[model samples]
Target: MSSTPPPLPPHALDRLRAAVRLREAGDAESARSELLALSGTYPRDPGLAYQTAWAHDVLGREAAAVPFYETALAGADALGAEDRHGVYLGLGSTYRVLGRYAEAVATLEAGLAAHPGDGALTVFLAMARHNTGAHHEAMSALLTLLADTSGDPGVRAFRKAIAFYAEDLDRVETGD
Candidate 1:
């Protein structure tokens, strides 16, 4: 049996593109409706599920987006790498906004495991950590991320110190 999912039908692809265009044109409700209609026809399509979740998120319906995001992730093997990454980010962010910090952390951690060195996942993980009262760990992550990725001259000059402090924010240097 072929492990790969079948390619989406041409008509479905065209419709999906149209729905995306509607979203880009600021018609999120129409895009969501179109995506929902398409989903009824291709309920197992990861791309469709992801797009549907995105539409709900854009409309500030985080709770509504959860199941669609879960559906997309459940069939993640059918999604392209970028889409899979996006599903992780979106679902994790949605959970965080909904006050489900633990789920957010777990989802983002899983995403990082799959896509290591992803700045976005690391950043969201930090937020989730903060919400879960892991303040020191959250600060450490943010500081490390800033130190590693910053290009500002001032930040660049202090990168080494920032990295050192990130490992132990509470450690104080004693004058010998």
Candidate 2:
């Protein structure tokens, strides 16, 4: 008797892609439904777990998002650098939503320290600082990031927002 290997599941990858599409389209409900289904099929699929966590975050269910984000981070840690960066970003964003500003700042800062000069993590750290009322510090970080030629466009735009916040902080600080 010859042993035969099992064939890959048809359309599984496609379904995962569709779930990611739904996530990008801002359809958190649909994204969660599809990603949850995918997770059920592949319990060890970190991407699906990450996306599901993101969907929960988009739906304002921050509490529900934390554990999934943690799982994704753990899985990504052992997988690949890019995947690990993504999970760190997702976890930082989720912590920000949960009003866990300190954790968000720490997490994003750790990611930036690991991947130095990473504009995305810089932006996230700035946001975390801003959320925690560290406006001056946030603005300083944003300015540093914006001055870097390699900084991301999205982060540059966020720098502008932080500048505005910084201006407001200045006014308040000066009693103007």
Candidate 3:
């Protein structure tokens, strides 16, 4: 038997695409239901798992999305390039929203390790840190990100650094 699997049916792909569009349009409940209906057929399709979780997350239902995100990560090979890392981001951010800041930190850190220099990971990591009341640590992490990204050609990092610093200055000035 061949090791390769056949391509997904066009109809199934279309359904997935439609679900994504529904989620983007803020009809996340419909999107989640649509994808949940397809889970048994595409058990290993990471995109399905990710999209299902995304709808839940977008609807502010983080707890429901957590397992789906974990499932998607457990079998991520079926995902596209952007989705492979995007799922990690979604999972980490969900954890943060749920007040599970430590899991958020670890998840985002793992994402950074897997996809080094990803700006999304850096930003989410900073957010997770801040949520955990580690403001200094968050700033340190962002500064490291700024240093790493600024060295790359044509990528602006100093602007972000300035923005963060400016926010801090304003907060301190207002005694917040």
Best by lDDT: 1
* Better-scoring candidate (TM-score), 1 or 3: 1
For each candidate, give its TM-score against the true structure: 0.94, 0.67, 0.73
How many backbone overlaps does candidate 1 show?
A: 0
Lowest summed lDDT window (length 10), candidate 1: 1-10
Candidates sorted by TM-score, best first = 1, 3, 2
- Residue-wise C-alpha lDDT for candidate 3, range 39-123, written one tens digit per residue: 6687666678888888888888889989889888876766777897988899998999888999999999989888988888889
In angstroms, how far off is 135's CA in candidate 3? 3.8
Ranking by lDDT: 1, 3, 2
Cα lDDT, all candidates: 0.94, 0.76, 0.81
Model 3 — TM-score against the truth? 0.73
In candidate 3, which residue pairs clash? none
In model 2, the runs with Cα more than 4 Å from the true position are 1-12, 78-81, 133-136, 149-176
Model 3 segments beyond 4 Å from truth? 1-8, 146-176
Report the C-alpha lDDT of model 1 over 14-85, residue by residue, as the tens digit. 999999999989999999999999988888788899999999999999999999999899888888899999
Reference-based lDDT, residue 42, model 1: 84
